[model samples]
Target: MTAISLPSAMEFIWLEADLLDSHDYAAWLALWTATGHYIIPTERDAEDYAAVLNVVYDDQEMREARVKRLQSGLSMSASPAARTVRTVSRFRAMDGAAGVFVVRCAQHIVEYKYDRTRMLAADVLFWLVPAASGISLQRKVVTLINGDDALHGIGYLL
Candidate 1:
Protein backbone atom coordinates (compact mmCIF):
# COMPACT_ATOMS: atom_id res chain seq x y z
CA MET A 1 0.00 0.00 0.00
CA THR A 2 1.28 3.43 -0.88
CA ALA A 3 1.24 6.04 1.86
CA ILE A 4 0.66 9.75 1.34
CA SER A 5 3.75 11.73 2.27
CA LEU A 6 3.78 15.44 2.95
CA PRO A 7 5.84 16.16 -0.11
CA SER A 8 3.53 14.25 -2.43
CA ALA A 9 0.46 15.90 -0.93
CA MET A 10 2.07 19.31 -1.35
CA GLU A 11 2.95 18.44 -4.92
CA PHE A 12 -0.65 17.63 -5.69
CA ILE A 13 -1.74 20.90 -4.12
CA TRP A 14 0.75 22.86 -6.19
CA LEU A 15 -0.48 21.16 -9.33
CA GLU A 16 -4.06 22.04 -8.47
CA ALA A 17 -3.07 25.63 -7.83
CA ASP A 18 -1.25 25.79 -11.13
CA LEU A 19 -4.27 24.43 -12.94
CA LEU A 20 -6.48 27.10 -11.39
CA ASP A 21 -3.98 29.88 -12.04
CA SER A 22 -3.84 28.89 -15.69
CA HIS A 23 -7.63 28.70 -15.98
CA ASP A 24 -7.34 25.04 -16.93
CA TYR A 25 -10.70 24.26 -15.44
CA ALA A 26 -11.12 20.95 -17.24
CA ALA A 27 -7.92 19.53 -15.84
CA TRP A 28 -8.69 21.00 -12.46
CA LEU A 29 -12.09 19.34 -12.47
CA ALA A 30 -10.47 16.00 -13.21
CA LEU A 31 -8.54 16.20 -9.95
CA TRP A 32 -11.63 15.61 -7.87
CA THR A 33 -13.51 12.48 -6.96
CA ALA A 34 -16.98 12.06 -8.32
CA THR A 35 -18.47 13.04 -4.96
CA GLY A 36 -16.07 15.85 -4.23
CA HIS A 37 -17.25 19.24 -3.12
CA TYR A 38 -15.66 22.63 -3.71
CA ILE A 39 -16.55 25.09 -1.01
CA ILE A 40 -15.84 28.69 -0.12
CA PRO A 41 -17.48 29.67 3.09
CA THR A 42 -18.87 33.11 3.89
CA GLU A 43 -17.74 32.76 7.50
CA ARG A 44 -14.10 32.32 8.39
CA ASP A 45 -14.81 29.98 11.29
CA ALA A 46 -17.68 28.13 9.80
CA GLU A 47 -17.86 24.50 10.99
CA ASP A 48 -21.03 23.07 9.57
CA TYR A 49 -20.78 24.45 6.07
CA ALA A 50 -24.13 23.10 5.07
CA ALA A 51 -25.84 25.16 7.77
CA VAL A 52 -24.14 28.42 6.97
CA LEU A 53 -24.32 30.64 3.93
CA ASN A 54 -21.34 30.12 1.63
CA VAL A 55 -19.81 32.01 -1.23
CA VAL A 56 -19.45 28.74 -3.14
CA TYR A 57 -20.59 25.23 -2.29
CA ASP A 58 -20.43 23.12 -5.39
CA ASP A 59 -20.82 19.43 -5.84
CA GLN A 60 -19.96 17.57 -9.02
CA GLU A 61 -23.03 18.76 -10.95
CA MET A 62 -22.70 22.31 -9.72
CA ARG A 63 -18.96 22.30 -10.42
CA GLU A 64 -19.61 21.25 -13.99
CA ALA A 65 -22.21 23.98 -14.41
CA ARG A 66 -19.89 26.57 -12.91
CA VAL A 67 -17.07 25.60 -15.23
CA LYS A 68 -19.40 25.85 -18.22
CA ARG A 69 -20.61 29.27 -17.13
CA LEU A 70 -17.07 30.53 -16.73
CA GLN A 71 -16.11 29.22 -20.14
CA SER A 72 -19.22 30.56 -21.81
CA GLY A 73 -19.37 34.12 -23.08
CA LEU A 74 -22.67 34.98 -21.48
CA SER A 75 -22.05 35.53 -17.75
CA MET A 76 -20.95 39.11 -17.36
CA SER A 77 -18.56 38.48 -14.51
CA ALA A 78 -17.02 35.59 -16.38
CA SER A 79 -17.05 37.10 -19.86
CA PRO A 80 -13.49 38.26 -19.34
CA ALA A 81 -12.26 36.16 -16.49
CA ALA A 82 -9.83 37.83 -14.16
CA ARG A 83 -6.28 36.61 -14.63
CA THR A 84 -4.97 35.03 -11.44
CA VAL A 85 -1.73 33.86 -9.90
CA ARG A 86 -1.90 31.75 -6.74
CA THR A 87 0.69 30.75 -4.18
CA VAL A 88 -0.04 27.89 -1.84
CA SER A 89 2.15 26.91 1.09
CA ARG A 90 2.34 26.16 4.82
CA PHE A 91 1.10 22.63 4.43
CA ARG A 92 0.19 20.27 7.24
CA ALA A 93 -1.04 16.74 6.76
CA MET A 94 -2.71 14.19 9.00
CA ASP A 95 -4.52 10.94 8.58
CA GLY A 96 -8.28 11.16 8.78
CA ALA A 97 -10.64 8.23 8.40
CA ALA A 98 -9.25 4.95 7.15
CA GLY A 99 -7.49 5.55 3.84
CA VAL A 100 -8.12 9.27 3.97
CA PHE A 101 -5.75 12.17 4.38
CA VAL A 102 -6.50 15.68 5.55
CA VAL A 103 -4.26 18.50 4.44
CA ARG A 104 -4.33 22.14 5.40
CA CYS A 105 -2.49 25.04 3.84
CA ALA A 106 -2.40 28.77 3.27
CA GLN A 107 -3.11 30.26 -0.14
CA HIS A 108 -2.66 33.78 -1.47
CA ILE A 109 -3.95 34.83 -4.85
CA VAL A 110 -3.29 37.91 -6.96
CA GLU A 111 -5.88 38.77 -9.56
CA TYR A 112 -5.52 41.38 -12.28
CA LYS A 113 -8.13 42.69 -14.66
CA TYR A 114 -9.16 46.02 -16.13
CA ASP A 115 -5.72 47.37 -15.19
CA ARG A 116 -6.30 46.74 -11.49
CA THR A 117 -4.80 44.13 -9.20
CA ARG A 118 -6.40 42.65 -6.08
CA MET A 119 -5.09 40.19 -3.52
CA LEU A 120 -7.01 37.45 -1.79
CA ALA A 121 -5.74 35.23 1.00
CA ALA A 122 -7.32 32.18 2.51
CA ASP A 123 -6.88 29.16 4.73
CA VAL A 124 -7.50 26.02 2.75
CA LEU A 125 -8.30 22.48 3.79
CA PHE A 126 -8.47 19.37 1.69
CA TRP A 127 -9.73 15.85 2.18
CA LEU A 128 -7.99 13.40 -0.09
CA VAL A 129 -8.60 9.79 -0.86
CA PRO A 130 -6.15 7.50 -2.55
CA ALA A 131 -7.06 6.49 -6.06
CA ALA A 132 -5.73 3.99 -8.56
CA SER A 133 -3.90 6.72 -10.39
CA GLY A 134 -2.72 8.64 -7.34
CA ILE A 135 -4.95 10.72 -5.09
CA SER A 136 -8.29 12.37 -5.60
CA LEU A 137 -9.85 15.33 -3.85
CA GLN A 138 -12.86 14.43 -1.78
CA ARG A 139 -13.47 17.91 -0.49
CA LYS A 140 -11.88 21.33 -0.65
CA VAL A 141 -12.76 24.20 1.63
CA VAL A 142 -11.43 27.72 1.25
CA THR A 143 -12.06 30.22 4.00
CA LEU A 144 -11.16 33.72 2.91
CA ILE A 145 -9.35 36.01 5.31
CA ASN A 146 -12.09 38.58 4.89
CA GLY A 147 -14.93 36.29 4.07
CA ASP A 148 -17.53 38.54 5.59
CA ASP A 149 -16.40 41.68 3.83
CA ALA A 150 -17.85 42.93 0.59
CA LEU A 151 -15.93 41.46 -2.31
CA HIS A 152 -16.42 41.53 -6.05
CA GLY A 153 -15.20 40.19 -9.37
CA ILE A 154 -14.13 36.73 -8.22
CA GLY A 155 -15.37 35.21 -11.43
CA TYR A 156 -12.44 32.87 -11.86
CA LEU A 157 -11.74 29.70 -9.93
CA LEU A 158 -9.73 30.13 -6.75
Candidate 2:
Protein backbone atom coordinates (compact mmCIF):
# COMPACT_ATOMS: atom_id res chain seq x y z
CA MET A 1 0.00 0.00 0.00
CA THR A 2 1.21 3.52 -0.78
CA ALA A 3 1.93 5.65 2.25
CA ILE A 4 -0.04 8.82 2.75
CA SER A 5 2.23 11.85 2.40
CA LEU A 6 2.98 14.00 5.43
CA PRO A 7 2.11 17.20 3.64
CA SER A 8 -1.25 15.83 2.62
CA ALA A 9 -2.08 14.78 6.14
CA MET A 10 -0.87 18.05 7.62
CA GLU A 11 -2.90 19.98 5.10
CA PHE A 12 -5.98 18.12 6.17
CA ILE A 13 -5.25 18.92 9.81
CA TRP A 14 -4.79 22.60 9.03
CA LEU A 15 -8.03 22.85 7.12
CA GLU A 16 -9.95 20.95 9.78
CA ALA A 17 -8.58 23.10 12.58
CA ASP A 18 -9.40 26.27 10.67
CA LEU A 19 -12.98 25.21 10.13
CA LEU A 20 -13.37 24.26 13.78
CA ASP A 21 -11.77 27.40 15.17
CA SER A 22 -13.81 29.59 12.88
CA HIS A 23 -17.02 27.93 14.07
CA ASP A 24 -18.10 26.94 10.56
CA TYR A 25 -20.17 24.16 12.07
CA ALA A 26 -22.09 23.26 8.93
CA ALA A 27 -19.04 23.08 6.73
CA TRP A 28 -17.18 21.19 9.38
CA LEU A 29 -19.96 18.70 9.89
CA ALA A 30 -20.08 17.99 6.17
CA LEU A 31 -16.57 16.62 6.19
CA TRP A 32 -17.40 13.49 8.15
CA THR A 33 -18.24 10.10 6.66
CA ALA A 34 -21.63 8.51 7.31
CA THR A 35 -20.33 6.20 10.04
CA GLY A 36 -18.05 8.75 11.64
CA HIS A 37 -17.81 8.91 15.40
CA TYR A 38 -16.82 11.80 17.62
CA ILE A 39 -15.60 10.73 21.03
CA ILE A 40 -14.27 12.54 24.04
CA PRO A 41 -12.64 10.17 26.44
CA THR A 42 -12.51 10.56 30.17
CA GLU A 43 -9.09 8.95 30.35
CA ARG A 44 -5.80 9.11 28.54
CA ASP A 45 -6.19 5.73 26.89
CA ALA A 46 -8.31 6.75 23.96
CA GLU A 47 -6.97 3.79 22.02
CA ASP A 48 -9.29 1.93 24.33
CA TYR A 49 -12.20 3.54 22.55
CA ALA A 50 -14.60 1.52 24.64
CA ALA A 51 -14.23 3.97 27.51
CA VAL A 52 -15.46 7.24 26.14
CA LEU A 53 -18.56 9.32 25.92
CA ASN A 54 -19.52 10.22 22.39
CA VAL A 55 -20.50 13.82 22.05
CA VAL A 56 -21.59 13.48 18.43
CA TYR A 57 -22.47 10.15 16.91
CA ASP A 58 -24.62 10.76 13.91
CA ASP A 59 -25.45 9.69 10.44
CA GLN A 60 -25.97 12.35 7.78
CA GLU A 61 -29.55 12.95 8.84
CA MET A 62 -28.74 13.32 12.50
CA ARG A 63 -25.83 15.59 11.76
CA GLU A 64 -28.18 17.75 9.69
CA ALA A 65 -30.57 18.00 12.60
CA ARG A 66 -27.74 19.20 14.86
CA VAL A 67 -26.78 21.87 12.38
CA LYS A 68 -30.37 22.94 12.04
CA ARG A 69 -30.70 23.40 15.78
CA LEU A 70 -27.63 25.56 15.86
CA GLN A 71 -28.91 27.77 13.03
CA SER A 72 -32.48 28.12 14.24
CA GLY A 73 -31.57 30.69 16.91
CA LEU A 74 -33.52 28.53 19.33
CA SER A 75 -30.48 27.25 21.26
CA MET A 76 -30.71 29.76 24.06
CA SER A 77 -27.58 28.42 25.69
CA ALA A 78 -25.56 29.90 22.87
CA SER A 79 -27.10 33.36 23.17
CA PRO A 80 -23.90 34.84 24.48
CA ALA A 81 -21.67 32.26 22.94
CA ALA A 82 -18.20 31.66 24.22
CA ARG A 83 -15.26 32.52 22.06
CA THR A 84 -13.01 29.57 21.24
CA VAL A 85 -9.48 29.13 19.99
CA ARG A 86 -7.99 25.72 19.36
CA THR A 87 -4.37 25.02 18.58
CA VAL A 88 -3.36 21.59 17.33
CA SER A 89 0.31 20.63 17.30
CA ARG A 90 2.76 17.72 17.30
CA PHE A 91 1.08 15.77 14.55
CA ARG A 92 2.39 12.26 13.91
CA ALA A 93 1.10 9.72 11.43
CA MET A 94 0.37 6.18 12.44
CA ASP A 95 -0.14 2.97 10.50
CA GLY A 96 -3.44 1.22 10.82
CA ALA A 97 -5.68 -1.33 9.12
CA ALA A 98 -9.25 -0.84 7.86
CA GLY A 99 -8.26 1.69 5.17
CA VAL A 100 -7.89 4.45 7.70
CA PHE A 101 -4.96 6.80 8.20
CA VAL A 102 -4.47 7.91 11.77
CA VAL A 103 -2.98 11.16 12.93
CA ARG A 104 -2.12 11.80 16.54
CA CYS A 105 -1.70 15.31 17.92
CA ALA A 106 -2.00 17.45 20.98
CA GLN A 107 -4.60 20.20 21.25
CA HIS A 108 -5.02 23.19 23.49
CA ILE A 109 -8.46 24.69 23.48
CA VAL A 110 -9.23 27.93 25.25
CA GLU A 111 -12.73 29.22 25.60
CA TYR A 112 -13.79 32.50 27.10
CA LYS A 113 -17.06 33.98 28.15
CA TYR A 114 -17.72 37.27 29.93
CA ASP A 115 -16.49 36.15 33.31
CA ARG A 116 -14.92 32.77 32.78
CA THR A 117 -12.10 31.32 30.80
CA ARG A 118 -11.66 27.57 30.44
CA MET A 119 -8.57 25.88 29.14
CA LEU A 120 -8.49 22.27 27.97
CA ALA A 121 -5.55 20.12 26.95
CA ALA A 122 -6.14 16.93 25.06
CA ASP A 123 -4.51 14.21 23.03
CA VAL A 124 -6.39 13.92 19.77
CA LEU A 125 -6.62 10.94 17.47
CA PHE A 126 -8.01 11.65 14.04
CA TRP A 127 -8.95 8.69 11.87
CA LEU A 128 -9.42 9.73 8.28
CA VAL A 129 -10.36 8.11 5.00
CA PRO A 130 -9.43 9.48 1.62
CA ALA A 131 -12.49 10.66 -0.23
CA ALA A 132 -13.19 12.12 -3.63
CA SER A 133 -13.30 15.65 -2.30
CA GLY A 134 -10.81 15.42 0.53
CA ILE A 135 -10.29 13.51 3.77
CA SER A 136 -13.45 12.28 5.45
CA LEU A 137 -13.30 11.76 9.18
CA GLN A 138 -13.92 8.22 10.33
CA ARG A 139 -13.39 8.97 13.96
CA LYS A 140 -12.23 11.91 16.04
CA VAL A 141 -11.32 10.80 19.51
CA VAL A 142 -10.24 13.41 22.01
CA THR A 143 -8.97 12.39 25.42
CA LEU A 144 -9.13 15.37 27.67
CA ILE A 145 -6.64 15.77 30.48
CA ASN A 146 -9.44 16.83 32.74
CA GLY A 147 -12.48 15.21 31.24
CA ASP A 148 -13.97 14.20 34.56
CA ASP A 149 -13.92 17.61 36.16
CA ALA A 150 -16.94 19.78 36.52
CA LEU A 151 -17.24 22.22 33.67
CA HIS A 152 -19.83 24.01 31.67
CA GLY A 153 -20.51 22.56 28.28
CA ILE A 154 -20.18 24.86 25.31
CA GLY A 155 -23.25 24.64 23.17
CA TYR A 156 -21.41 24.35 19.88
CA LEU A 157 -18.64 22.21 18.52
CA LEU A 158 -15.49 21.88 20.57
Tell me the tens digit of each residue's lDDT in model 1 across 5-105. Answer: 78888999999999988889999989999999999998887678888899999999999999999998899888788888999999998657877789999
TM-score of 1: 0.95
Task: Please state the error at residue 155 of candidate 1 in Å.
Answer: 0.8
Q: For residues 84-151, what per-residue lDDT tens digits would candidate 2 score against the true structure?
A: 78898899988777778999999898888878888888888888888887678888877677776655
Q: What does candidate 1 score in Cα RMSD to the true structure?
A: 1.2
Pairs that collide, model 1: none
Candidate 1 regions with alpha-carbon error over 4 angstroms: none
Whole-model Cα lDDT per candidate? 0.90, 0.75
Report the Cα lDDT for residue 120, model 1: 97
Residue 133 of model 1 has an lDDT of: 73
Local distance difference test, candidate 1 = 0.90
- The model with the greatest TM-score is 1
